[model samples]
Target: MTLLPDPAEARAARLACRQGAPRPTAGMAPGFTQCNMISLPKDWAWDFLLYAQRNPKPCPVLDVTDPGSHRTALAPKADLRTDIPLYRIWRDGVLAEETPDATAAWAEHPDLVTFLIGCSFTFETPLQQAGIEVRHIAQGCNVPMFLTDRDCRPAGRLHGKMVVSMRPIPAGRVAEAAMISGRTPAVHGAPVHIGAPEALGIADLSRPDFGDPVQIRPGEVPVFWACGVTPQAALMASKPPFAITHAPGYMFITDVPDTHWQV
Candidate 1:
């Protein structure tokens, strides 16, 4: 497997992302934690924080930045406004534009507070170490994500259905996959569902609400994990006047080590 050490790998990835050529960060810094970032106005920060706390599985809080600031404790040298590969601008909960950086958004709305939420990619390294194949990475595409029938608890104006990322695991190794990922609650943690896509209101595995679809081969069972994308869906539901989020699969690379998330 490819190995890029923490911090250095993260810094290089951030530099590449800042170059205006945005792409998925999955498999980039293998052992570093890739984070889901959302910047909201201070007026909406408290409710969003509550939403995360109440829906910890999908919105695990990794680190939060001070209001009007782009720096986070997760990576002192990183600029949250531009380090992510892609940024989504949401106006009244509707995605307005997708860009490589949030500099313009930050400049326009200085009161935005940033939230660095945990991502499942943090645990993918250990899964790879355990000999599990991450098919999307192997296929050179973004992980498959879907909106589910499950609902996340609402915090004030924020409420929406849960979203999940799917990984096709060999039946024989499903237990091992669960064990490996279950240890990292700071990330999305374990699988929320293991077999049926239809049960989650996902009609087809090949079609996803966010990210690219990956082939689920024969003899493999589809595993679903509560995804950070849930918040974006919630933002869409709640219709916040303004917000900024990392595009699906395009996450913020942090100095935090993957091991730091292991419980």
Candidate 2:
């Protein structure tokens, strides 16, 4: 089993990530909030904001930074360019490169505006405490994520299918898992679907569009949650000229306590 990150070590964990740790953030910084990041050019900000507002389930907006600024009210001391474990540089909707540090991209586009979307990882600790097994964390790897046929409401230039993260829960605990996660609507809220991968148009669970696949034990049902990475799916479909996002499964850890968002 993967060792859970210290709740009190949010700053320390971010510092480690800044120093080039390549591990996924799942199960890391357990009590601190983790979020999906997407930085788009200044001109694209309003459209993206509208998109997130229209699709709150998969794109709950946590904190948005000012144009050309690297700071977020979510974490004052953390640097967005370097604190995330990994980043994807997108050009004209194509994935240009994955990098550990993104200072160059920020330096190049001073008008890049960053948005922090709530991550399902924020609710995992509560699920575990409620005795639900989070398969990906138990497997010591990144959570599995998939793109579904379900469409998100479009806002201006943004439009795409929804993306989801899956966790295999025992059939008996599926409802419990949903309830535990639903307490914090800001962080994905609840399972969007339980069992039946094909229902979402996901052909197979073993192969995921992003992140690693986790095992689905016989009695366990695959539960899906609205994923913040849906923005990347939009980037792929809409083909924005320039954008930067956290690599799937890698997240930006914020100093905010997870409980702060819990009901």
Candidate 3:
């Protein structure tokens, strides 16, 4: 396996993404922190911040940029507008456009406040180091994400159902995987559910609201983690006039090391 990525690699990954390499970033910059991004209007910042605070499990915040700023403290030199592999523009609760670059959108909305939220990918390395197979990475695909029946605590104009990223873990190792991940509370600590898609309002494992599906081999049980993508779902349900988010599975790689969040 490749050694843990260094800061240079992290920067290079972001640069590659900025330059238009449209690909999923699951195992990219392994061992470095990766984040989910949401850039909202400054007027709605307080409301969203409260929403995130109210639902920390799915919206754990890492760094929030100042209004109109294109940078985050998570990566001093990284451009939030273009460093992510792909971006989704939401207008009035509808997906407007999917782009590799969001510079134009950022310029149009100068009051945008960017939020860098924690991601489950941070715990992937630890899971791998412990001899577990993260099915999505092993299969070279994006993690499958689904919307649950549970509604999140609403704040201001933000409201939506919880979204979860699923990984099929060996039934015997489900507890071990949860404990390993539980150590990183800042990055979506642990599995919210295990082995029962129906319980989460998911009717099929093959179809996901976001991201691609991975195989669930024999004796492997499905495990779900609170996803930062939940914010996008809230945008749809709450009908925010304008918003920007990292396209599911295409994350913003940060300068922080994964170990920084590990307990």
Model 2 — which ten-residue stretch has the worst lDDT?
Answer: 1-10
Q: After superposing candidate 3, which stretches have Cα over 4 Å from the reference?
A: 1-4
Candidate 1 whole-model C-alpha lDDT, 0 to 1 = 0.91
Q: Estimate each model's TM-score.
A: 0.97, 0.96, 0.97
Candidate 3, residues 1-263, lDDT tens digits: the string is 55556799898889888896699999998889999999999999999999999999999999999899997888999888889999999999999999999999989898999999999999999999999999889999999999999899999888999999999999899999999999999999998999878998999999999999888899999999999999999999999899999999999999999989877
Candidate 1's residue-wise lDDT over 7-30, tens digit each?
Answer: 777788778888957889999877
Per-residue lDDT for 66 in model 1?
Answer: 85
lDDT of 2 by residue, 2-121 (tens): 445455589988988889668899988888899999999999999999999999999999999999899999989899999999999999999999999999988889899999999999
Q: lDDT of each model, Cα atoms only?
A: 0.91, 0.93, 0.93
lDDT ranking of the models: 3, 2, 1
Task: Assess the local accuracy of residue 110 in candidate 3 as a C-alpha lDDT between 0 and 100.
Answer: 83
